[model samples]
Target: MAPSWVNDRSYYQEDCPIYFATDFRQIRNSLSHADYRRINGGNRITLSEFYKQYHKYIMLLYQNGRELWSIQNIEKIDLGDVTEFNRMIFE
Candidate 1:
């Protein structure tokens, strides 16, 4: 399956956070607390089922993670590039 981040050739578009964050929360909870359920809604799904749903989007998650890492490690904040920065963040 195609990665989820590329919606209309852009990132941070439709369903971006949900496509990654929900699965991350589910897996994190499963590993840390043995809470294999929907993180927000209290619905339950087996780990296998969660894996089936999540497997396809792994690349999406990885790409977003890398983007976040790059942003976090920035050495300087150039005010001149505010527009680009805003697009990177708020878009």
Candidate 2:
């Protein structure tokens, strides 16, 4: 079964489009406290937990529409080792 947030269309509308984050940690940190409360019931959670809960909806919009795509799948990666590989190569 899909998560409740996936079925809840209230967060996705013409004026309030869903935001996508390629790096789950960055996006999770970017969310305002109110957003966290609204979507996550005010419980503090790790980025992996957040991604496990929301990645489906993010992927849905990414594959179907203009929303940005984040990591294809959530896997265990060392937070300290995460660097912008693209920037190093492209810059």
lDDT of 2 by residue, 1-91 (tens): 8568665766454342243344454555547444644454344554566576566666665677542224333243334434354234334
Winning candidate number (lDDT): 1
Q: lDDT score, residue 66, model 2?
A: 44
Off by over 4 Å in 1: 1-24, 34-43, 71-91
For candidate 2, the TM-score is 0.26
CA RMSD for every model?
8.8, 12.5
lDDT on C-alpha atoms for all candidate structures = 0.57, 0.50
Q: What's the count of clashing pairs in each model shown?
A: 0, 1
Q: Write candidate 1's Cα lDDT for 18-44 as tens digits.
A: 545666666667667845243443565
How close to the true structure is residue 19 of candidate 1, measured as C-alpha lDDT? 44
Window of ten residues with lowest summed lDDT in model 1: 8-17
Best by TM-score: 1
Model 1 Cα RMSD, 1 decimal: 8.8
